[model samples]
Target: MFPMQFALKRGMKAEMPDMDIARNLDIEKPRSRSNSHNEILTKDIAGALLDVIRDLKSTLEDSRKSLSHSAGAGCRCSTTGTTLSTLDEYSTSGPRSSDMMGIPPEIMSYVRTFGHEPATASDLMDWLTEFEDTMEILGLDGQNGTLDKRSVVARLALKGKARKVVLAKRAWLARQGQQLSWAEVQKSLRLAYRAHIPEHAMESRLCRFNPQEHSEEGTGLLIQRVLEIMNMGESHDNEYRLFYIISTLPDDIKDILLRRPCPTDEVELIGRVEDIELLKVSMAMNGREQGKGRKR
Candidate 1:
């Protein structure tokens, strides 16, 4: 017998190795291990599921923070096409977008400067053009050739019907492999809301603004009134436009103008009309200052 092996005392049972003892004991496997492959696979899947759940929770928290910090808050949309039909409602009937909390302060403030509410796409385009010009003037588009847009669209009166139209445009633009820019989006809005003026109606309105009716009015006031009406008609003909302005002049002024050799160019004629108005303005200002000096 080797020195490491000790002989047992009399009547002592032979002690088996731990391996043999475990095999004979019919003991359950260690809690940390499993003999069944299905159980191990199940555990692995459960662990992976837990990880995904944690990641999703974290993502949701970040989204909440972003919405709270930005204009995207409360700006929810459904995937269905319900939002498209109501596009004009928010810009017209709904509350002012400038009054909303999530709207970017700059965009919201700029939108409120519109002379007319953007009830149609054309009105919105005008607003966008003005907005872009004002932004350029203020140096918002940076030296890096990029602008700090900062959810500018979200600040627009774009909820409900407007949002739907935007979404549809987005898909169409993507299909054409076109990148969506702020100006482009506004262009789409314009297409959606463009108004077609009838030729007959425009001509009628232009004719109805009679210069003779305003003969009793101040020279400046009559010119201003005529121009405003012309704008409402959206007339494009320079010759036609100049003729309207000239026809509105008081008979005395008209006679004086008619005596002068008319300029060949339509632009020159418009300039001449503007010059007469300016002379009237100068005379009126001189009269005001003279009255003020008399009081002194």
Candidate 2:
């Protein structure tokens, strides 16, 4: 009887080790290489999504170019053999004849900067607000209006129904905490015209800009104006510190005026004063060219 009891106890001890090994395997399973692959899988999915969005945007723009000249005849049918209905059927209504005029070059430039995202009316308003804030930091608000952007945008968006739609959309986005792209904003403007949103609400006290008279000249103007403000400060550090204040501009502005474009001209102008390495080389090259000109 004693020998049998000892045999049973040894067998139970052997099985206990196997149970611990199984428990450890279960706990550590998620740490396997398969889990590591999930991060890579997520990145691939994001890349695919962006590519699809780009394709959709390209198709939309191509369709717009073709249909804008069709004179209300409606779009051409797809390969599926169904007639493509007028955008008005899906959208609000046909745009008025007057609404077919030209889009501003600055507006076009703005939209092109965003790549493939669809533009909406709200995005244009936000851009106006952003640019205005940038100008304000440079002390370029010659009109000295209130700093409230909603008020400012409402006043500047005065181009008729388009402006009104932009303002309302912006207001809605602001309430919803949603941001729109420049391309999206432009798309919304075109779509709004089809949707038959009334043009009357657009004629607000704030939506009344005349760009020829009120526009900031260009990027150079803003830079020059900012330098002037910096020059007025008492201490050298105070002048240098204005940069920290300007850095508060949104990331979108930074992407445009700072990152992609590199602000080469602006940087070169500053390099003349600061004489950093790249700037020094550029200035030396300029000097050599000028000397050759003088010799001629």
Candidate 1 RMSD to the correct structure: 35.9
TM-score of 1: 0.22
Compute the lDDT of residue 120 as modeled in candidate 2.
37
Query: How high is the CA lDDT of each candidate model?
Result: 0.37, 0.32
lDDT by residue for model 2 (1-296), tens: 11322221221111111223324323122222232221111222323333433443344455454554553565443332333344332222322221221223334343333331214323433443433332222122112221222122222222233444555665666576454433344344344533552343322211233222222232223334345544665543333222322222222222222321122122222222221222233334355766898999
lDDT of 1: 0.37
Candidate 1 per-residue lDDT, tens place, 131-163, comes to: 333322222222233322311221122222233
TM-score of each candidate?
0.22, 0.17
Residue 108 lDDT (model 1): 34
Candidate 1 total steric clashes? 4
